[model samples]
Structure formats: C-alpha cells, structure tokens
Target: MKTALTELVGIRHPVVQTGMGWVAGPRLVSATAEAGGLGILASATMTYDELAAAIKEVKSRTSEPFGVNLRADAEDAARRVELLITEEVRVASFALAPKKDMIARLKDNNVLVVPSVGAARHAEKVAGWGADAVIVQGGEGGGHTGGVATTLLLPSVLDAVDIPVVAAGGFFDGRGLAAALAYGAAGVAMGTRFLLTRESTVPDEIKQAYLARDLNGTVVTRKVDGMPHRVLRTELVDALESAGPVSGLARAARNAAKFRKLTGLSWRSLATEGLRMKRGGDRTWSQVLMAANTPMLLRAGLVEGDRSAGVLASGQVVGLLDDLPAVGDLIETIVADATGILRRLASE
Candidate 1:
C-alpha cells in the first residue's frame, strides 16, 4: 500500500477520501484518517470560523495526517491559506490551481500542496509551480468535471508531470487501485465511494438513493452551474435540463442571494467574486450568476436531505456500489485486495 502519496502525506495507505462538500466533515475525515488513509476536509462550503472549528475537531478525533481542500479562487483564499499554515495542517488540496505564489507560500511553510487537475497541461503548470503532487480527475467524476475519461486522462497527466499523480473518477474498488498503479499513478482518490461509506454524514435515505442507481443512472449536464456537472438523474435534474435559460437564471439569482446570506457575505463581495469568476473563465454574466446556484442546491440535497428539492452530485461509479461499509473496513479491504492482486501479478 505504500507509495509516493503515502510517503508524501505520511499516510499508511495509498487511498484518499476526497474532500467532498457537505460529506467530508470531521466525523468522516477522522474515520478515514483512523483507517490510515488521507482524509481531506472540504472547506469550500464552510465559513472561515467553521473550517477552523472542524480542523480542531478532526485533530481531537485523530492525530493521523490529513488535508484540507480549498477554493483557490475564493475571495478569502489567502486568508484560508494562512489558516492552514497556522493550524499546521499536513496538506493543502485545491479545487482550482492556486497562484504560483500561493503554492510557494504553502510549500515554504512545509505544507504539501496537491491540486486537482482535469488536464495534463494543468498538472504540468502546478508541478512547475512546486505542487507536491496532483490528483487528476476525469469526466466521470461528480460535480463540475471535464470530458475526458480517467483511463485516457490519467496516463496523459503522468506523462506530463514528474510529481506523484493520484488517479480519480470512476474508481471504487481495489481492482481500480491496482489498475491506477499499473497505469503509473502513485495512488487513487475517490469521492463517490467514500461518500457512500457508513461514516459519511449523508442521510441514510440519500445513501440508499445513490446505491439504487445503475450504470446509466447519472447524467452530465451544464445546467447545474453553467459547467458540465455529473449528477444522479433525479427529477430535479431533469427539470433543470428542460427549463429555459431565463427561468434558470432567475432561480440562480435567488440561490445566489440565499448563499450570500448563509455565508454572511456582503452583496458587494458576492458581486466581486462573481466578476472574478467571469473574468477568469471568460464566462457570460448569466453563466457567472448561474454558478451561484451550486452551493445552495447542493446544500439542500446533501445537508438538508431534501431529495425532491436538492441535486445530488455523483460520479457514475454509483451504479457499482451497493453496500455502506465503515471507513476503516473499506480502506482495509481495498489495501488488502490490491496487495493480493499486485503480488499475484508479480508471481506470475
């Protein structure tokens, strides 16, 4: 189970429980850490104070190494970086590639930087900027994702960067881990698989809903946030796809306001963040406003357990998952299974 990722983050297993929003809180993270895998706390959905408290809670629950996933483009990105440094977090994983100086600042403080990348060039960019490693997620990943499959995308990134690459997207079992390692990846990162675990705080009904899916149960649509997002094919998702642009924008505006209120952000600050997103991605004003819909909608489904009202972000791997094992049992099984597979191949 030992690999560059294990050595890089000081974890015993090469598996990683992704920092999934609403699901990767202290309870889930601590369980994953106790299981000897890197458990990343998802900070994108939390306020600064909440993140600090969650980090403290994780430390209280387990002393094993873990990471925090951050939104590098957020208005408080720098402040959050400082929080990680002050908290002595072992690793910092970014949803978006952070500025070079941010990478330098984190590295200087001895925090390992690992950003999720969708393409080989992005892996190279972050690697050149001193990222300790990169997690390359493919089109099958949940939420906002690219259009490339991991089988193709993983090798391209491995070829493009010398740093340790963790393969993500469409991975759920020990066999997938063995395949990723065979493909030259240091390890594997999984979001949906971890989300379906027993330690996950997601409501049992929601977990059942995810487990009820098949191979064709998920759909990738841009209606979620003006970007290609993979999610379970729910009635709400179908409605969103069929709705007109004007209606979509109206709903997005309302959600944006709600999100602002929940986060205690000023209207001016929200607008500024929207503008930054627009400029950075060359997105339309409508698309920028639509982007605001993600957090609130996800919160409704994941946190509030409103299946009819909220959209569930999910990877297509949901079809293959049926049981909810405890985090410790899941990781132990994956490690043992992968070891047997690799050893058998070597003996052959």
Candidate 2:
C-alpha cells in the first residue's frame, strides 16, 4: 500500500477520496483520513467562510493528512491559497492548473500542489510549473471529462511527467489499484466509488439510484455547462440534450441569479467571474452564460435530493457498484486486496 503517493502526503495508503462538490464534506473527509487515505475537501461549492469552518471541523475530527480541492480560476483563488497556508493544510489540489507563481507560493509555504489534469500535455505543464504531483483523470470520470480513456491516458501522462501520477477515472476496487500500480502510477483516486460510501452526505435514495445503474447507464453530453459532462441517464439529462439553445440560456440565466444570491455575491462580482471564465478559453458568451447552470443544478440534485429537477454527476463505474460500505472499511479492503494481488503476482 505504501508508495510515493503515500510518502508524499504522509498517508498510510495510496488511495484518495476525490473532491466531489456536494458529497465531500468534513464528515466524509475526516472518515477517509481516519482510514489512512488522503481525503480531499471540495471547496468549489463553498463560500470562503464555509471553507474555513469546514477545514477547522476536519482538523477537529481527525489529525491525519488531507487536501482541499478548489478552482484555480476563481476570483478568490489567491485568498483561498493564503487560507490554506495559514491553516497549514497538507495538500492543495486544483480543478485546473494553477499559475506558476501560485504553485511557487504554495510550495514555499510547505503545501503540496496537486492539480487534476485530463491530458498528458497538461500534466507536463503543471509538472514544469513545480506541482508536487498530478492526478490524471480520464474520460470515464464523473462531471466534466475529456474523451480519452484512463488505460491510454494514464501512461501518456506518466511518460510526459517525472512527478508522481495518480490514476483516476473508472477506478473502484483493489484490482483497479493493482492495475494502476502496474501501469506505473503511484496510486489511484476515486470519486464515484467514494460518493457511494456510507459516510457520504448524499441522500440514501440518490445513492440507490446510482447503485441501480449498469455499465451503460451513464452518458456523456455537452449540454451541461457547455462541456462534456458524464452523468447518469436521467430524464432531466435527456431533456437538456433535447432542449434548444435559447431555452438552455434562459434557464442558465435564472440559475446564475440564484447562485449569486446563495453565495452572497453581487451582480458585478458574478459578471467579473464570468468574464474571467470567458477569457480562460475559446468559450463563447453563450457558453459562458451556460456555465452558471452547473452549481445550481448540481445543488438541486445532490444537496436538495430532488432527482426529477436536477442532474447527477456520475462516473460510468456506477454500474459496477452495488453496496455502500463505510469509508474505513472500503479503504482497508482495497489496500489489503491490492497487497494480496501484488504479492501473488510476485510469487508467480
């Protein structure tokens, strides 16, 4: 179970519970930490004050090392970085590659920078910018994902970067961990698997809905936030795919306003953030407007448990999962099973 990832983060196992927006909170994160894995708190959904309080609560629940996942392009990115430094967080995982100076600042403050990338080139870029490690997620990952499978993408990134690489996307069991290690990765990270666990904050009915899916139950569509998002094939998702652009934009605008109210952000701040998002890529103004749809829609499904009105971000691995074990039991089983498999292979 010990690997570069374990050594790098001071965790006993080379397993990570990913930062799922509504699911990864203090209780689940602390449970993962207590089980000896690196649990990441999802801060993209929280306000600054909420993040601070959640970090404090995690520290109170467990002394083991953990991480916080945030959006690098957020308006308060620098402020969040400072908070991590002041709180002495063990790891800072970014949803996007952070600026070079931001990486330097975090590293100088003794916080490890681990960004999640979807491509080999991105891994190279972040590694060159002084990231301690990178988590390479493939197309099968939940939420926004690329088109490459992990079996192909993981090696491409491993070849492109010298830093430790954690394989993500489509990983759920110890056999997957063994396979990832065999492929030269330091470890594996799981989001959907962890989200189905007993400690996860997601409602039970929702968990059952995820568990009922088969391998072909998920679909990738660009209707969600103008990006390729993998989610369960729900009626809401089907409707989104069939809806016209005009209707989508109208809904997105309303959600944007609601998100602003919930987060206590002014109209000017939201407009500025939207502009920043637009400048970050080749996104059109319509795409930028649609971007506001993600947080509120996800909140409706994940936090409010209204399945008919919301969309559930899920990995294809949902089909293979059927049970909800506690976080501690899940990690222990994965590590032990992986150890046995590796040992048997060596003996052969």
Candidate 3:
C-alpha cells in the first residue's frame, strides 16, 4: 500500500478518511490514524478555538500523523494556518484551493499541503501554487462537487499534475482503490465510504438509511444551496427541490443566521465571506449566506439523529454501503481486498 501519499504523509496505507463536517472529529481521526490510514479532522465547521482544541485532542489520542481540513476562504484562515503550523500537523488539507501565500507559509514550516479539488484545472492550480499533493474528487462525491465523473476526472487530473493525486467520489472498496491506482493515482480518498463506517459519528438510524440505498438512491441538486451538491433523496431534499429558489433562499437565510450565531461569526464576517463567494462566481450573496447553513443542517441529521429536518450530504456510494465495521477493521479489509484484487488482475 506504500505510495507517494503514504510516504509523504508517513501513514501505512494509501487510503484517506477525508474531513466531513461534524463527522470527522478527534475520535474518528485518531481511529483512522491508528488503523494506518490518513485521517483528517474537518475544521471548516469548527471555530478557531474548537479547531485548535480538536487538533490537540487528536495528538493526545494518537501519535500517528493526521491532517486538518480547513476552509481557505474563512476570514481567520491565516490564524488557523498559524495554529496548524504551531501544532506541526503532518498534513494540511483545504476544502478549497488555498492562497499561494498560505501554501508558502505551510511549506516554509515543512508541512505537507494537500488541497482537495473537484476538477483537473483546480488540481493543476494548486500544484502550480506549490501544493505537495492534491485530492481530486469527482461529481459523485458528497457536498460541493463538480460535474465530471471519477473515471474521467481522476485521469484528467493525474495527466495534468505531477504531484500525487488521490482519487475520490464513488470510491468505497478495494476494487475502487485498485481502479484508482490503475488509473495512475497515488491513492484514494473517501467521504461517504468512511461516513458509513463504525468510526463515524453519524447516528445508527441514519447510517441504516444510507446502507439501504443503492446506486440509484442518491440525487444531485442545486437546491441544497446554489451549487451542485449530491445527497440522499430524502423528503426534505425533495421539498427543497420542489420549493424553487425563493423558498429555498428563505430557509437558507434562517439556517445561515443560526449557523452564524452558533459559530460566533459576526455579521461583518458573514458579509465578507458572502462577498468572497460572490466574487468566486461559484455562488451569489444569498447562496453564500446559505452556505454556512449546510453544516448545521447536516449536523441535525448526522449528529442529532434527526433525518426529517436535517439534510444528509452524501455520495452515490452510500447506496452501496451495507455494513458498519470498526475503523481498524474497515481499513484492514480494504487493504486486503485491494491486494487480492490487484494480485488476481496481475495473474489475468
């Protein structure tokens, strides 16, 4: 399982448990790290103080190296970057492409920067900006995503970037991992796959719901905000889809205010972030305010165990997941299965 990712990040397996908001906490991160996989704590949903505490908590739980996924657009992104440098984290992962200056600062401190991208162009952008590695997720992934499927996106990114590329989106098993490697990827990154694992903090009832789904169970819609997000087709999702943009925006605004209050984001900071989102051309002011709503909405279903009012951000792979094994067991199973698959393919 040794590859550039494992060697660079000092993990035993090439598999990575990516940061999922309100899901990838210290317990899960430590568990993944202990199992020889790279575990990343999702800091996008956390306050600066919370992120700092979580980082320390992970360090106390496991001596193994793990990463922290941060929102590059957060106003305090610079402060968060300093916290990561101060903690000497093994790898710094970004939900979006970090600024060149931020990447330079981490590199200067001898930290590995691996930003997650949804397209080949983004992969090239981050790599050119001096990122040590990149995780390319395709359209089938959970949360914010692009339109290209993994089969097309992974190779496109691999061909475009010289740095190690970790393939994500619709990857859940050893066969998927093997396929990524065959496509010339360094390894595989997973979100929905790990979300259904025993290590995840998602509730049992919700996890069961995810397991019952099949490839056709999930749907991609812009109703979640304005971006094309893939999620399980629940009643709430259907409502949002049918409500049109006005109604959705109203709900999004309420959720945004709630999230702002919960996370202690000031109106000024919220407005500033909104402006950045607008300038990015990926979303509008209304959509930007609603962007903060997603984490809380997801938390309601994932953490509070309420699926009716909460939105569960998921990949199409959720339908394929049937069991919830311990993190250690899951990692070992993936490695063994991948090894067997690779060997069998070689024999053929």
Candidate 4:
C-alpha cells in the first residue's frame, strides 16, 4: 500500500486513476480522491477557465490531494502552470515531456511534477530535470502509446531513474499491482479501469460498449493522430484506416476548424500549439493538422456518447474488465487484495 508514490502524493494507497480525457471529470476525480487514490483531472480538453472551475469543484467535493493532467505543448502552458501554482494543486502531470522551466516553476511552488513517459530515456531526462516522479505507460495503454511491453519497459525505466516510476498499461486489478511492485515500480496508473467505474461520467451506452470488448478488441493505428494511438476497433476507426492520405488530410482540416471553434482558440493560437507539438517530436505539418482530429473524435464518443461516429480510446485491459464498481469499493478491494498478495509472497 504505502510506496514512494503514496509518500510523494500523501495518498493512503499507491493506486492512481489516470486523467483520461472527457472521462476524468470532477465527480470521478473527487470520488477517487476520497477513495484514497491519487485522481488526476484531465485538462488538455478543458479551457483555462473550465480547468480552474473543475479544480475548485473537486476541492469542494474532497479535501484529499489530487493532480491535473496537462498537455505540455499547449500554447497556454505557462498560464496553466501559473493557475496550478496559484490554486496550490498537489501535483501536475504532463502528457509529453515538460520543459525544464515548467518543472522548475511547479517545484518552486511545492507542486509535485509527474510526466508520463514511454521510454527509459524520457524517464531519465525528466528525472534529471527534477521531476518528482514518472508514470511509464507501455504499448497496452490507451490513447497515444509506444511499442514496448510493460514487462520490458518497466524495468528499463526503473534501471535508468532513481525517482519513483508508476507502472501503467494493461493494469486493472490488485494482482497487477503486486506484479508492478515486484517489477520495482512505485505504483500503478490505470486509465480504462477507472473510466469504467460507476463514478465515471462516461455515458452508460459507452461504458457498455467498453465492457463488451475482449482482449483482441482494441487496435493500434497511426491513422487517428499520425502517431500510434490505441483505440477500440470501431466502424469509425476502420473508415479512418481505409481512407487515403489525401482524404485523411481533408478530414483533418475540417476537424481542425471544428476543434478551433469548439475550444474558442484563435488560428494563431492553434498554429502555435501545432508548431510546438511538431517541434517537440519531429512531426510533419500534416501530422500537426491530423493531431486536431483527436479531441473532436474523442468528444463525439466520450462526451456525446455517439458510438457510430466517435472512437473509444481504450487499453487492452478492457478485455478483463467485466463489472463497474463504485470508486471507493474498487480502491478498497484492490488495496486489500494487493496487501494479501504481497504478504503471501513474502511469507513464501
């Protein structure tokens, strides 16, 4: 139960409910926080004002420490960091590697910084730059992911970084928690498992679709965002795969415009964010435009509950998840089981 992550975030258990976009809202976050796990509110899809309001709402619901997941390449990254500092959020998590200065500023304000990395080098980079901890998500994780399996990637990151590393990707239960601890991780971070909980705000229909899936239900495709993205194989995803490059670019353009309007972002602002993303990872201009497709497509399914038109970002763990439990019960059960497993192993 108590690990470096628990000590770092002051949570009773080492379990973490990842900040899944559109799913990790105030209700689920507060529920997880109250359940004694570190619940991170996803802020990439939220406007600056919306993020502040959601943070306040979570604070109103639970006094326990929580974190905000941020897009390190967002145009308003500085302002967001300032907001977190001003509001005194306990932690800040980054989707991509954060700049040294951003990490420095948050640490200066006593906010713990945890960047999710896919490789040992990235983990080492952030660890050297004073990140409080790292969440290493492997290929089995939903959304943007890498090719390495957690079994291999976890140890590589552990060997490279002295800071706490939370294992993610394909983790859903207490047995996985014990396995991660045995792998020398500080804890585990789960996105899909938390998203399927009763406390999650995802539409029931969407949850049902997720629950119906099996181990082979998800697909990893670069068609979604020009980067490897793991999503449940749906009709929309199939169509995307079948589309030609020219057609894909056309769709990306339209969605870029839609996302700009939906988020009230100016063309200049979108361009700045796009350029930042491109520079960070050597992405092409076309890839930058395709990147806009992620939020809108995810919103159609996750927020509007449209299965026919939207795509579901899901981990391979969806196969193992069959029931929806309340956040409190889920956390309690996981903690109890993991403790027993650890005890049994130690005695053996």
| Tens-digit lDDT string for candidate 3 (97-213) | 999999999999988999998777888889999999999998988888888999998999998999999999988888888898899988899988888888788899989988988
Candidate 3, which segments miss by more than 4 Å at Cα? none
Minimum summed lDDT over a 10-residue window in model 3 is located at 282-291
RMSD each, Å: 0.9, 1.1, 1.3, 1.1
- Give model 2's TM-score versus the native structure: 0.98
Q: Is candidate 1 or candidate 3 better by lDDT?
A: 1
User: Candidate 2 regions off by >4 Å?
Assistant: none
User: Whole-model lDDT, candidate 1?
Assistant: 0.92
Tens digits of per-residue lDDT for model 1 on 1-348?
789999889999999889988889999999999999999999989988999999999999999999999998777889999999999999999998999999999999989999999999999999999999999998998888899999899999999999999999988889999999999999999999999988999998899999999999999988978889999999999999999989999999999999888767678877887888887886888888888799999988898999998989999999999999999999999989999999999999
Stretch of 10 with least lDDT, candidate 1: 261-270
**Relative to the true structure, how large is the alpha-carbon lDDT of every model?**
0.92, 0.92, 0.88, 0.93
lDDT per residue as tens, model 4, 1-348 = 789999989999999999888899999999999999999999988988999999999999999999999988787889999999998999999988899999999999999999999999999899999999999998999999999999999999999999999999999888999999999999999999999999899999999999999999999999978899999999889999998889889988998999888776788988887887788797888888898899888999999999998879999999999999999999999889999999998999
Error of 3 at 159 (Å): 0.6
Q: Identify the runs in model 1 with alpha carbons over 4 angstroms from their true place.
A: none
lDDT of predicted model 4:
0.93
Candidate 2 lDDT tens digits, 182-238: 999999999999999999999888888899999999999888788889999999999
The alpha-carbon deviation from the true structure for residue 346 of candidate 3, after best TM-score superposition, in angstroms, is 2.1
